[model samples]
Target: MSTPGRGLHGRVLDTLGPAITAGEYPAGSVLRTDELAQRFEVSRSVMREAVRVLESMHLVESRRRVGVTVLAECEWNVYDPQVIRWRLAGSERPRQLRSLTVLRSAVEPVAAGLAARLATPEQCAELTECALGMVANSRGHRLEEYLFHDVAFHRVVLTASGNEMFARLGGVVAEVLAGRTHHDVMFEDPDPAAVTLHVQVAEAVRARDAERAERLTREITEGALQELDILAP
Candidate 1:
């Protein structure tokens, strides 16, 4: 998050954000603005602005005359999507995946229940369509196609919940889904049981069966957690 700016600041933030998260600049390491400016062929002002963005993420601390210092892993705002992306891109991926799965488990089941209670007929129909698309893509061994529908299904659940805070988390849900696929954590051939459960959940939401919606959603997230466990080294 580079202060919503343009050009050099974005470039510097892009280059350095992941690098720091990936431990190229490990905890407590100092980043000299002059050195970074020279290395990136940018002006000092631009480099300082970039550092300010990193500081906002709590990845680093800039002090007058003390240079910008990389903070400990615990100090970062891990929920920030940029931070999560950087961690996913690094060796810390397994831990990040587990953390995100825990979050998904905690939120999505409740969202599904609320969707059942609150979603309009049109929203419900779209959710069902997404679920059906997932089943079709899974049967065809189309992993990427399956992922698109899968992401849509979850996004619909959140949005249809009629809760602004929960709806706002759709981006986070999308990131986790895409991240799993990108990291090859997702099965190449989608799980048949998982596909069935998705359809069941969609139907439950359509029928306004809150209990079934919640239960089925929990089952889906549990399956995901199990996969993460199996993949964990």
Candidate 2:
């Protein structure tokens, strides 16, 4: 049996999510408890529970007697699933693509380096397996092979970073890849050079050559960005 809280919570989230993304409740707009409760036909307690979910996502913040207010873009949790969905749905502008690429360039190379120096043997083996699996999956058909390996490779890199904060970025990285995987750019003919680059990255990490691993990982990602035209030389 679905709990009343669960159903009411979903309705509140659905209603408020559209409003927030549509700019009906633009950043800094105050959300009133009574007004929202009446509009959604839910009790005040149920409305509060929905607001908590939004707050957790960094979409809204509660203030003493000021109620809940929409947060600025900087304050919103871009990694939040809801935020990612909204951004992709609202506008997948070139600038956003470029920004995401730039972020990956900055974070991923360091992660690779750290992984080379710190990853357990098991982690290294998993990385190699993922790379090999990718090659096999791409045989006669590229499909989503590269994308799956791409996300897995980076996820392990982050995990091997030995920093919880960096590892936490796995979700954001995965989301970015998943969002763009269906685009034509990612589905083009396989590039042997790209595949070789992945092999090189795995080898470098396996050899525990931190600098070499970092450089190779950077090259691979930068090449991808260049192919997408999201980065310029």
Candidate 3:
């Protein structure tokens, strides 16, 4: 989820971010910058910059002499896509995916309702196009393509809701969708019913039927939950 860590400091985060999220460094664990510099073979300056990035993410806090202390998970900005990506790759995958699906269920239905009422003509057109792209890629080992459209479709819906809070979740939703496709129990073709429901949700949004849009979105999220139970449990 991070850019390729070719930059010196970037390389440190590429290792440390996931390792911290994966619990390699538990809460309250203290790491000396000098030791980390030696281990990663980076200069002290590069290591310090990496620690600063982690601090910004609330993953760690650096002090003058106390070294870097891993923060409690509750302090982390879990919405960061990189944190989600790392968790989804670790032993925490099942739990992380479930939590994110539950979050989507709670937020997306309401966002779709708002989108139906507030979306501009241009947004409506974009929704239909994304829905069609999803349809075209719904079968025959085309998950990567379907995922592209699915993420776009939801991003547009959340953005068109006219709430900046909802709009900010687009990346979170994208990570969840990508996790489902690339890391979760989804191995076969996407559910046709889910695809159909997305198209219907788009139709309802375009028609400005907020109630219908909400209801259809609820169905989509419920189906996602059902898939987790049936496929992973």
Candidate 4:
């Protein structure tokens, strides 16, 4: 719902967030509100809101005399949406992808397994619809379709997981996928085998086979990572 340029505060935050993340300010470097407002062509009030957002993200700390200073990486709230966006926009390094994939590997399969045990009939139907949508859109280079189904598929898995923590992972998943989408990294042909694996996971969930669902989910995620490596190379 948040459109680019609509909110001055968000735009300012987006601009400054990346600068800090990319080390333009660096750790302990002071950020001047007036300088940033001038740089981004925004008013001080908008700039202040952006600074507040950054503070919440732990990217910058505001002090009375020193202005705002960038924090160390360990202090950052990586899970914050703005922080994730900044990271994605700051660089395109394989190490970032690898780190995200590792996180996914740890979380998604367990989510899938839990969803298998907990999904309601309606959720199962929605999951099937999402999978079928993927198959339908796989024919041409329908990137949005792929992304839609891909996001939906994962959302269902998270919902089925019956854990609020797992559901909260949706933001991270969306952020990573948005980056991949911007890079035109979704499968051009919609890998049938991958789609089939998704279906298998869906079926396992429908059947309440938690173990199979988890195993299939892991396989699907790992396969995608392998393909990403090949493509990025």
Candidate 5:
């Protein structure tokens, strides 16, 4: 069940965030609260809350003299899940995929190395279990379940790294995985090699083999990027 704030706020954010990212609401355009309230047929408070969320994302700013002004794309919080989802839904989705894939390739490999050195035994067990769960879900055609664990798998790796900055990337990993799955970038059946690689990476981390962990992680991420290229329409 969704909270009222999430239900309404997310709807408004989804509507406007994508519009902003897609260039429907270009920079310098002012968004009036009264107009938005009327347009969405919601209460002023709900409209204000929606705008406040967008402002926090750095996609817009409410000024004293002026209304809420859309900022340039560069000003937007690229790491925000909502912003990433909006970008993935836009015409420039391919570009977003490429950039995010590169970022994952760069960051996750290093994260895996750190996780191997710093992860607790419990974290390693969780990662191994998550990877194994992926195989079961994939075999059963439980795609949503598979994706949930897949996201969990990466999130665990990020969090296990013990570096606060690396831990922050868990959401980014979730965004890419969810966005890709939602867009049908992932097929119904999981790749056996990918699953195998995931298990290998987990085992490497468990064994404290940092070199192997990093190498296997790089392989997994690189494979994903290749798949994205193949799936690009």
Candidate 6:
């Protein structure tokens, strides 16, 4: 739950958010701000700020008379990057990764098709550059670098789609890709065929081959799902 670059309030969120998503505080559970502050050894103000952040994510609702009530998972903004990160950090990570991959399967192929049709020359260049980066880092235990390009590749595809809704999923896609790399589930080297597929998708998009782009992107996401199934802990 603890990563760098977080302030005091963010630290509280780092701990508390993962706990909530992990069901340590189940749905309908009421949490007192003051008690939580005391338990975390933080001031009430910090706790309040943390609670406010969670409220925005619909993970909890603050009631004046009552307390912060944990909402059901159905009500959560699962696409929120922070929420996605917290979920990936928790015990439910395998399921979380699978669910996110399924989401990509649903959205990214269409996005890829649109990118093929609408991508600007600059965006197409970016896609090719990202693909080359992935190829460069796919082996020799260069996972972190490969992950960077992988996340960027998907983000470029989404943004080039000319759809704001799909574009906003950049962060969601980022968290999922980072989760797979950081968590122990991935292979030492990324799957070779998967890397090749990314390159092909990039080429298809650059060529303005909408149908091929969509099909290749579908293959990428399908491989991700299969990866989760094969690598599930």
The per-model lDDT (C-alpha) reads 0.87, 0.76, 0.91, 0.81, 0.86, 0.90
Candidate 2 residue spans exceeding 4 A from truth: 1-7, 21-24, 63-67, 92-97
- TM-score, every prediction: 0.90, 0.83, 0.91, 0.86, 0.82, 0.86
* Winner on TM-score (2 vs 5): 2
The digit string of per-residue lDDT tens for model 1 on 1-233 reads 12433689888877688789888877989979999999999999999888888999999999989899999989999978778877877788778878888888989999999999999999999999999999889865588899899999999999999999888778877877887777656656888999999999999999999999999999999988887773445
Candidate 3, residues 11-41, lDDT tens digits: the string is: 7888788899999988999999999999999
User: Candidate 1, 6: how far from true, in Å?
Assistant: 4.6
lDDT leaderboard ranking: 3, 6, 1, 5, 4, 2
TM-score of decoy 1: 0.90
Better candidate number, 1 or 3, judged by lDDT: 3
Specify the poorest-scoring 10-residue window by lDDT in model 3. Answer: 224-233
Model 5 C-alpha lDDT versus the unseen true structure: 0.86
List candidate 6 segments past 4 Å from native: 1-8, 41-43, 230-233
Worst 10 residues of 6 by lDDT: 1-10
Instruction: Choose the strongest candidate by lDDT.
Output: 3
Q: How close is candidate 5 to the true structure, as a TM-score?
A: 0.82
lDDT of 1 at 85: 72
lDDT of 5 by residue, 23-112 (tens): 898899998988998898888898899999999999999998799999998998998866776787789888887888889999999999
TM-score of candidate 3 versus the correct structure, residues matched by position: 0.91
Tens digit per residue, CA lDDT, model 6, 134-213: 99999999988999999999999999999999999888788878888886567689999999999999999989999999
Q: What is the C-alpha RMSD of each candidate to the true structure, in Å?
A: 2.9, 3.7, 2.4, 3.0, 3.4, 3.1
